[model samples]
Target: MIRLMQHADIHSVFNIEQQVQSHPWSLKQFAEAVDSYQCTVIEQQGQLVGFCILQPVLDEANLLLMAVAPDQQGNGLGYQLLEHSIEQLPNQPVQIFLEVRESNTAAIRLYEKAGFHQIDVRKNYYPNPDGTREHAVIMVKACSDDFAALFSSP
Candidate 1:
């Protein structure tokens, strides 16, 4: 099931974030996201398995963060979480943007499959645990006329 994130979900979501991201968002960040962003979580068998955070301003939206539990990845949960979050944006966004670490090819491919294309690269945008920095690939997608229809019905 996919639904709006609740305060109770923070710990579960943060666990996945820590497990899957080299640089994870802090608990305070998650608290703020739950308070301010369009945060959605996906549950499987009553366990939170994935989540996506988005920020919408007028006709544009930014995918702030997204993640799936390591054991649950490669099973389409991330894609589902992403598409659902986009469709649920408060405004009918004409454009959506997101940035991903250059080394995360899986996420890049997932975004590409969802119609997002790379528009630019931010040099050394993300810091690694090893003290190295990596580029961030900026991707954008035009939310055309059939933006909602383009996604398969759940």
Candidate 2:
């Protein structure tokens, strides 16, 4: 189920963050983010499977963070979470933006499949676990009336 993230969900959210992200956010960081940003989690059978964090303004949003349990990736949970996040955006001329590590092909593919298009490249934006640097691929999806209608259609 896709729902608003609660304080209790931060523990599981932080666990996934540590397991999947090279530079994981600290528990306090997650707590602070949840306090400020819009957070959503996918829970199933009473366990949190994935989560996404966003900073939204009037008509656009920045997808600051998203992660799934390492063991649960490639099971469509990530796509569902992404779709749900977009679907729940505030009613307006919505656009969502995000950055993905260049080496993260799986995540890039998921974003592309959900209709995001690359806009620019931030050189050496992400640090690798092996003491190297990776570029961040910035992507955005503009959800104007036609775009929203495209997804809402049968």
Candidate 3:
């Protein structure tokens, strides 16, 4: 089941973030996002499987964070979470944007398959624990008539 994130889901979500992200969002950071952004979680058999965080402004929306438990990766949960979040946008957004770590090939493929295309790059954006830095690829998707149809059909 997918539902709005509640305070109680923070622990699980934070754990997944830590497991999947090299620079995980701290629990406090998650708290702030939960307080001000649109957050949702997907549960399977009472276990928190995945979650997505988004920020919408006017006709544009930004997907701030998305994660799936490490054990749950490759099962299509991330794609489902992303599409579900898009469907839950406060208003029908004409565009959605997000940045992905240049090294995260799986996520890049997922976003591309969802219709987002790389538009630009941010230099040395993500800090690595090993003192290295990674660039971020900015991706965008135009959610016009054909894109909106993704939600209405079936």
lDDT of 3 by residue, 1-154 (tens): 8899988889999999988887788999888888888999999899999999999977789999998888899999899989999998778788999999999999999999999999999999999889999999999989887466766779
Worst 10 contiguous positions by lDDT, candidate 3: 144-153
Clashes of each: 0, 0, 0
Give candidate 1's whole-model lDDT: 0.91
lDDT of 2 by residue, 6-69 (tens): 8988899999998988799999988998898789999878889999998887667888899999
| lDDT at residue 64 of model 2 (Cα atoms) | 89
Q: Considering every candidate listed, which one attains the maximal TM-score? A: 1
Q: Candidate 1 on 1-154: residue-level lDDT in tens?
A: 9999998899999999999887799999999999998999999999999999998876688999999988999999989889888888876687999999998999999999999999999999999889989999999999887466546537
Q: Could you tell me which 10 consecutive residues in candidate 2 have the lowest summed lDDT?
A: 86-95
Per-residue lDDT value at 129 in model 1: 83
Score every model by TM-score: 0.92, 0.89, 0.91
lDDT of 3: 0.91
Clash pairs (backbone) in predicted model 1? none
In model 2, which runs have C-alpha deviations exceeding 4 angstroms? Answer: 146-154
User: How well does candidate 2 score on lDDT at residue 67?
Assistant: 91
lDDT of each: 0.91, 0.87, 0.91
Model 3 TM-score? 0.91
